[model samples]
Target: MGTVEETLKCPVCQDFFTDPVSLSCGHDFCLTCIQAVWETEGSDEVPFFCPECQIFLPSDVTLEINTNLQTKAHALLHQQRSALREHTVVEVTGDPLSLKCQEHRDELKLFCMEEMVPVCCLCVLVGMHKNHKVFQLHEACVDFKTSAADFKERISDKYSRIRVVLDGDERLMMQIIDAEEMYMTEWLEAQRGHMEAQIKEIDSLRASRKSLLQEEIELRFLQQIKAQNLWNPLDLTPIQEVDKDLCDLEKLTTVERLVDDLSVALSQHFPRMWSHLSSPALDSKSAHPKLEISQDRKQVYWRTQPVSEALSPQPYDSQYSVLAQESFTTGRHYWEVIVQEKPYWLVGVTTGPVDKRDALSQSSSSLGVHNTSWCIYHGYGQYLACHDTQEKQLSVGKRVRKLGILANLQKGELSFYNADTMTLLHSFCVQCTEPIYPMLNPCIDASGLNTQPLTMFWIKDHWDWHINTEGAKE
Candidate 1:
């Protein structure tokens, strides 16, 4: 019942619809007017809502022509055109559809690339976009369209190559899994065959031992019978008259020997459960200048000289620190240091590229105050583990003479042990990124009374013995 003009008006522009389209919410709108509203209101990938019902419209929503609405709009427009033709008396004015700046009321002829907006001649001269990079509106539109095309082509090419790349990766993974499976199967089969052979050999040896025992039992029984029959009842003498050969001890000795051999074989076949000792020598370059090193480079101690001669002009920095020549980056390694009766000592590992300057005042520059190093310090009857400027007190019993360090770089574990008792004192779980070297600090006592040297215990490869012929001359 409403007027055709009123019914055909667009909600956005408040004018007759140019090309009408219907939304999913059963609302009609001018296609160009709805598009402009959406472009201004939402991002390209975001959904827009209907003005009346607030119904959701997808970013890729298709605009279908509303035939009925279009026909009504066209009829109303025709009537307006006829009325305009009949009047045709006043002077013509500028196009109402031309875009104009809101403030200046002048035509928007240029686009400011820097500000990403349109500007009129007046805006360029005095507005906020003055001196900004700009181009003609048509030229800006053409450039944007070309860039959009290039972006779309690149996205299409990437999408086309995705399937091939994924297929190759999946194939490689499957091949790796298959290879691992084959290797494990072969290894398991070989181990099974070896175990079966050992079991068979054990069974054969057990049967042979059982037969020997049976023979011995029978022989002993026969000897007992013979001795009972030959017993002297009148004299009540023992069965000494029986042959001494009958009482054979060789069989018992053979069984004992067999048991001992089996024990030795079993021990040789199994891997050792304890950590193996390794020899680590001190790196002379890492030693403090005042510390003295033995000829073997396995021991270090503070120099026993006058204070003025031994001490450096500059105060002690990391002058007490020393590192081992051996560096561990992977796998497990263990070494022990003899710190018997030492009043002050520190042992741990440090990564290379460490700061060796005199910065004792700063905890960050000192050992065990950063991620690069970790150590256990012993002083004044207290034990502490230090790392990243944090110290943790350890509850270790009586002081131990020998200290052991076990490092498993792959597992990111460093363990300190009491070598005398083979007991773990403390352990640290760390995040190691580089090769680590054993570090030691042979600290001098405050009263300068303790001078015990820190020695690395090395297992000798050969032993030498000398005879004292001087006693014979005497």
Candidate 2:
């Protein structure tokens, strides 16, 4: 049989263990010895292999003290000392870790963040670690932080794949909506044409009959009345009856419920969006002479008369429009606006510096009409998306009161939404060269009807705060 010393030696260290640890391969080694071996031969970026067994272990495998081996080692030392009572020495008052500075004899307490090691008071005050940084043991540890960071990255990778599936679903749903809108629009237009023809015939018959009555001669009036025989009562109803529900209340409610559920399921992504959810205020400096911004800077509206006060040095040549104060240069951002019951308005984003040459001239540098901007315009019973003077007529299922804008700079895309229903209205793809600012235009007041100011909608400090308000769940 081998000596007692040979049986207690670590496989890697080849010495008596100090904080022994056991691997799943049934091999034992000193904790520090195994750490040094793996750190030099392998790494946290790759699987760790047992030095003796060569068995692979996950990179995240934690190193911890083997209590059974430590107890056995302590017992063996106790028995060896008992056999030589003349030289007995023990210090039961030491710390549980049995660690103490060789010179100061103080417990190793603080951890030096820079050096990645434990330190004592004198080591931090006057020794080698005098100028090194440190933290209390209970406050933070490199091991715990590294482990947490690695695990968080894994979770984020998995969630990113899940988001891809959700995005595909969203795209499919939007296509279906567009298709249904197109078919319904065709039917509505045909019915409207038929109604117009019937009204024109009725108007012609009424005018001719009135002229016959004013014929002056009684004989001619009688003859004219005989020649013009009055037709049977006209059918005022539509020629083709509406078989399907135009407004399905049940389906709308179901949509709202589904959106609510989606909002909850996707709350994980909200922190990113919410972190930048600043309801950017209207920049009065960018407003037209006839446009007015609220005192609080959240609302903007077109005025009947121009501002009488002396205007600033900047040009006041906008089309009753203004840009937001905040500008975004990178990353994905979402913002919303309230256009509730307003008849005419425009909402969009603009990139690059404002041109002093045109200011807000509708024909020159107007939003959506200019190459540097994109916008959604509503006026005279039409919802249209405009970019670079090219207009794409949008088919919105319902009247949009709230508008949502999502600007994804990395992907080079901008998406507009029907905020109330979370339905996508349109999206634009553009490569940005610089910063982009949110733009708002409360179009000209028509006969004192569309005077309501456009209001900004956004999340403040809470989660699950905005699903009902607009296109986003805050």
Candidate 3:
């Protein structure tokens, strides 16, 4: 080959970019290629500018010639392109064979922890594998096989359990979504009603105000016309010199001001109408339900189940205290048992306390107390009833006494019966998640005489009331 001048030149140097320096930008060219620009007047740094873009480089510049790039450049410069390429390939393949220690050379073996490949013993104490978690080549494979089985079984079981939970969550998620959509519809309806009511009020006010103003304007104009007509040239005595000019100006100014005020009021108050119409307000909870995996990867529960009238009642409810005790105390409170059920369920006074009036001691006005605790049913509502005991003589109005609140309808309904006469009380519909409070007949005075106080609840087909000390165990 002819003497290769190009071979002596750096490819990055091309003409003068030899002894090339590489910038952070990955552009490689001779030092001279970028040095001048970096040293330009007003330039704060030298040998620190990107050659291609003239973008300034940081002060902590590193311009080392990349060995791989230099090699490639040199190969390009040489006339033997194919041979150079082949030489590069051989360089990549030819890692020098590591020598084995004399002691292990004859039967040398090694284990690669990373690759899990067995190597000659010499490779073990050499590059890369020296600090690796390795065992003797023969022992490593056996250990791996043992551990792999255990891990496989464990992982499989975990994933299987996860799949089961995932299936449950998927089903529950659909219900949750449906519940949320229903809740949103209800909430939106409520909000729309409220807003429309306000809108109607505002429109009424506007109409009334406009009508009054228009009447005033018309009256003023009429007065002005009357004044102008009085000055008809043919009229006799100038009619007290009707000043139409003054009348016209006064009416015009009043009408203009009134219109302006109404316009401003409308703009200020009704500005949000379009926005509300376009993007309605979301319920307290977003309609969207999010599904996420638990940190421990356990069962899934809803973050929010959405609020619907059918599912949840307002929080600070006082109706739950229908048959609250006069004085709450242990063993002294009254128990209202619904004897109609097989379980003979009852929840009554557990604490000794009473809401009081003056001049009355616990004997006169004892109130019933409850544990305030309840049983929660998954996918259903909880059931509870206040204990009405002799400790407190709670009274109900005639109407309330005739009607008893029903609750936990999903499990069963609550109906009250006169413990004495066993009379049937009226049954009431129980909304979801709401506890029923049965308004009671007047407290039986200490004499055990039943008074005709307003009592709620009528007789169901067959129900009885009984007090068993054994069942009263707290």
Best by lDDT: 2
- Model 1 clash count equals 0
Q: How far in Å is the alpha carbon of 402 misplaced in model 3?
A: 99
lDDT of 3 at 357: 28
Per-candidate TM-score against the hidden true structure: 0.38, 0.38, 0.15
What is the per-residue lDDT of model 1 for residues 375-442, given as tens digits with 9 covering 90 to 100?
A: 88887678888876788999988787899988877798999999879789989996887778888777
Where does candidate 3 have its weakest 10-residue lDDT segment? 278-287
Count: clashes, candidate 2: 2
After superposition on all C-alphas, the RMSD of every candidate to the true structure, in Å, is 32.0, 27.9, 36.7
| Per-residue alpha-carbon lDDT of candidate 3 for residues 1-474, written as tens digits (9 for 90 to 100) | 323445344343455225567777766666665565566644563436564677777887866755555555455544345554533222311112322333344333556777565556555566445666667755886888889998999999998997897577567655665666677667667766766776676677567546544655777766755654633543222113334553344443554575577558755754221121111111111111221222422211122323345522322122111232222111111123222211111222112222322212333123223232121100112233333321222232221111112232454433343343434442222232323222211211111111112211223342211223235433
What lDDT is obtained when candidate 1 is compared to the true structure?
0.71
- Candidate 1 regions with alpha-carbon error over 4 angstroms: 1-275, 308-318, 354-366, 462-474
lDDT of 2 by residue, 177-292 (tens): 66666776787788778878877877886788788768999987777766765444534443455456763445445555776788788775655544445688778877776788
Decoy 3 TM-score against native: 0.15
**Residue-level error in angstroms, candidate 3, position 44:** 5.6
Q: How many pairs collide in each candidate, listed in order?
A: 0, 2, 35
